[model samples]
Target: MNKTPLNHWHREHGAKMIDFGGWEMPVSYEGILAEHHGVRQACGLFDICHMGEIEIKGAGAWEMIQSLTSNDVRRLADGQAQYSLLMNSDGYAIDDILVYRRSADHVLLCVNAANTEKDLAHLLAHARPDAQIIDLSADTALLALQGPASVDVLRRLGVELNSVPRFHTLDIAVAGVPVLFSRTGYTGEAGCELFFPAAHAVKVWELLLAAGADAHCRPIGLAARDTLRLEMGYVLYGHELSESITPLEAGLEWVIRWDAGDFLGKSHLQAQKQAGLGRQVVGLKLLEKGIPREGMNVVAADQPVGRVLSGTLSPMLQQGIATALIDRAVLSGASEFFVDIRGKMKKAQIIKPPFIQRG
Candidate 1:
């Protein structure tokens, strides 16, 4: 398994290590519950260095990247980022990704760890013959500080919080280390992702932890990361999306831009939008006593209606919430359904997603 430069520090800090994709990463530090709440109320630090960062440069870079994804790349300005999806030729999603427009000639794509290599090969195959693509994952380190207090913490570090607009980035020196700071995060909170050289990552992590605010900053890991995203009703790559699933079915139509023009998946997506959808992804709130797990059958009136793509006993909502795909016909009747949890069917209710929206 690949280990990040801060592997030793994670061990020293009592992080529960786990194998994620090909990288060994922390599952939690002070524990999942503690860290989850920390990120919600105060702040928590996360090591996201294992995620892939590939740079596409050269005069034809934008032309090359535009062919592979579902969204329009031409709209992105310098230092601006947009969420997009990698698609199969059939128009199904390979993964949802974030693309950073560094300049007219350079774009950076951040992909999920598991899909990094596949994403590289996929993009390289169609890249302009002369355009340059570089994988800087091995040499880079990424950390995220998230919570309501994030902006305040960054202000203490001498950054004007209001200046870094959402989806914008600043290549600035922080704590004596040159780092690329992006105003982005998976958590539905105010946050920023700091990308810096691998060697100095440990010091950066230490600085955040040492800077005390309301309820001191601490290490958060994969466990809380999963819960956090789920609460926001955000789609996970493998769970809520795959090459078999289109972004339209994943409730991600916001990311698609029709006016961007002449991109892959545009034709099929346009048809889907016009003709209406057969299935829609919706949220389920478990009213029954059982916890909903992934792939569990969702039954409506004792008959299998759909499948649960992602589910959890939400810490914030204090209820089991899940994202599921179901026939559009059942949506109105979805007020009550059964989740086949561990062989027994338990009651559930359909509701708007984001079981935990920002207050």
Candidate 2:
């Protein structure tokens, strides 16, 4: 199995490791519940070096990126980033990625670990002959510090917390190592994602721990990360998003740029927009006691309407919550629904996310 640069550190810290996608990652450190509360109340540290990073350079870089991604690339000025999607001809998502515009001639694409190679190949296939593309996954290491007190923790580490706006990036040195610091995160918090040399992984990790001592920050794992994102209604790649699902069907039409000129799936997306969406992703809250899981049936009026894509017992809300892709007609017409848990049907209510607002 694949392992990140901080794998040994995770094991040393007594983390329960699990195989996520193909990488051996920590599922929990102290405990999932404890880690979840830590991030919500104080702050938490995460090793996210398993994600993939790709670089595009040269005069054609801007044009090449514009033609490949769903979001308006022209709107991204220097030192800014945008959450976008890489799409296929059928309008299905190849992968959801974050595009960082370092400059007109230099850009970076951060993609999911599972789809790294696939996304890279797709980009290379459509890139112009003059565009220079390079994969920097092996050389880059990323770390995330998140939660309500995240800014205070970073300020203790000598970072100018107020200057870097959300979705913006800066190049600076932390602990004497060059770092690419981006004010972005998955956990819906005021935090920063730091990218630095792979060789400096342990040093940076140790420094962050020492710096955040007074802030009461703890090391978090994948288990809590999953729950945190679910509470925020953020989409996960394999669950809320997939190769067979289009952005409109996933309720991500906001990211689709209709007036950005020609793109990979513009024609198909335009057609769908004109015809209207047949299905949609919706949030579900269980009215009765029961935990909702993936592949569970969603029923309306004693008949199947859709299947749960991602669900969990929200640690913050203390209730069962879920996201499902159901038929648009059924979802709009029905006021209430049910989730089939084992042989029992649990009552539920359709609601818009997010289940828990960030504190």
Candidate 3:
């Protein structure tokens, strides 16, 4: 398994390690529950070095990126970012990505760790003669400082974040280390994602933890990260999305730009939209005392309607919550359903997600 720059620190701190997307990463340190609550109540630091970063530059960069991603890149100005998807010809998701526009001639893509190589290859295969694509994953290390007190913690390190807007990037120095800092996160909290040279990972990690000591910022792990994102109804690449699933079916139509002329899967997505959808993704909250798991069958009126894609006992709500892709016909009439768990049916109610709402 591949190891991040902070692997030795995690081992020394007695973090329970696990293999995630071919990288050996911490699942927890104090515990998942503690770390999960830490981020929600105060702040938490995360080593996200394993995620991939690709840079596209040249005169043709804008045209190439506009044709590849579903979101309208023309809407992004320098130092801004937008969430987007790479789709195949059949309207299926190739991968969901973050497009960071540095300029009309330059853009950066932050891709899922597991799909880095595949995403890179996809970009290379479609490369235009004037565009140059480079894989910067190996040289870049990402760190996330998240929660309500995250800004205060950064202030302690002499980094003022008041000037940077959310979803925007700022080139700044944190404790003397130059970084590309963005006011963005997966935990649905006020925070920032810091990208810097891989060599400074250990130094930056320790610095943030020390500076955040008074605010109770602990080093979070992959397990807590999963729960945090799941609580917000954010789609995981393999679970809520895959090569077989299209963005339309995943309840991600908001990410698509109809006015953006001619993308890779535009025709197929248009056809699917015009024909109407057969299935739709929705949230489920268990009324009983059982946690839902992926692939569990969802039934209504003794008929199977869908299958759970992602589920967990929400740490904040203390209830079982999940996201499922169900038959669209059932959504109009059925507000409740049953999840078959170990041959027993558990009652669940359908609701719009971001299960735990925040201000």
Candidate 4:
């Protein structure tokens, strides 16, 4: 199994380690619920070094990325990042990535750890002779300190939060080590994702912890990470997204840039846009007692109409909630459906995504 640079620190801090994809990662430090609430009320830090970072350089980088992703990365100025998708010929999503345009000739793609090999292979297959692709996942260490109080926590590190706008970044020297601070995060709260030298990982981690002491921040794990993203309706690679699913089917049509011009999956996505997919992904908020589990059946009029993709006992809502790929035929015509949880049926309503948003 693969391990990030901070693996030793995680084990020493009493983290519950588990195999996530091909990597041995931390599931929780103190506990999942405690870490979840900590990020909600104060702040918390996450070690996201497991994510892959790929560099696209050379003069053709702009044209190369434009031909690959659904988002309009070319329009972005230097240092701007956009959330996008890498697709296959059928328009199915390979992975949802963040494209950072460092310059006209230099672009950075941050992809999921599990899909690093697949995504790199797919991109390299189509890369032009002038374009150069570099994999720097092993050398990068990513840290995230997030919450309403994150600004104050980072201020102690000499980064002014108010001046750092969203989707923007700055180079800073923290604890005498060079680091790049990006005002972005998976959590729908004000936060920054920091990338620094792998050699300085221990020092930066310790500094952030000591600075956030008054803010009551602590180390968070993958369990809380999953739950927090679910509450915000953020799509997980294997759960809400997959190789067979398109952006339109997943309610992510906004990310598709058909007006920009032809790209890899242009024709297929445009055809689906014009004709429409038979199924749609929607959020399910359980009204009755029971937690919805993945692969559970969604029934309408005593017949299975769809299947749950992701579900959980929502800590904030105090009820079970889920996201599912429901039959568009029934979803558009009906208001609610029953989830078969442990052989018992529970009622839930169909709603638009983003069940919880940050304040």
Best by lDDT: 3
Which 10-residue window in model 3 sums to the lowest lDDT? Answer: 156-165
Which residues of candidate 1, in runs, are more than 4 Å off? 213-215, 333-335
259-306 in candidate 2: lDDT tens per residue? 898888889988998998888888999989888999999999888999
For each candidate, give its TM-score against the true structure: 0.95, 0.98, 0.98, 0.98
Over 96-124, each residue of candidate 4 has an lDDT whose tens digit, in order, gives 99888888899888899999999999988
Deviating ranges (above 4 Å) for candidate 4: none
Question: By summed lDDT, which 10 consecutive residues of candidate 4 come out lowest?
Answer: 350-359
Per-residue C-alpha lDDT of model 3 across residues 194-283, encoded as one tens digit per residue = 999999999999999999999999999999999999999999998888886779999899999999899998999999999999998889
Pairs that clash in candidate 3: none
Clashes of 3: 0
Global lDDT scores for all candidate models = 0.85, 0.90, 0.92, 0.87
Candidate 2 Cα misplacement greater than 4 A, ranges: none
Q: Write down the lDDT that model 3 would get.
A: 0.92
User: Candidate 1, residues 1-359: lDDT per residue as tens digits?
Assistant: 99988899999988889999989999998878888888999888899999989999999898877877778888788988989987766767777899999898888988898998998888877777768999988888999888878777788788866688888999889788998889999889888999898989889888877763554788899999999999999899988778766788888888777776666667888888899888878889998666788899999877888899998888887889899988888877656688998888888988888888784
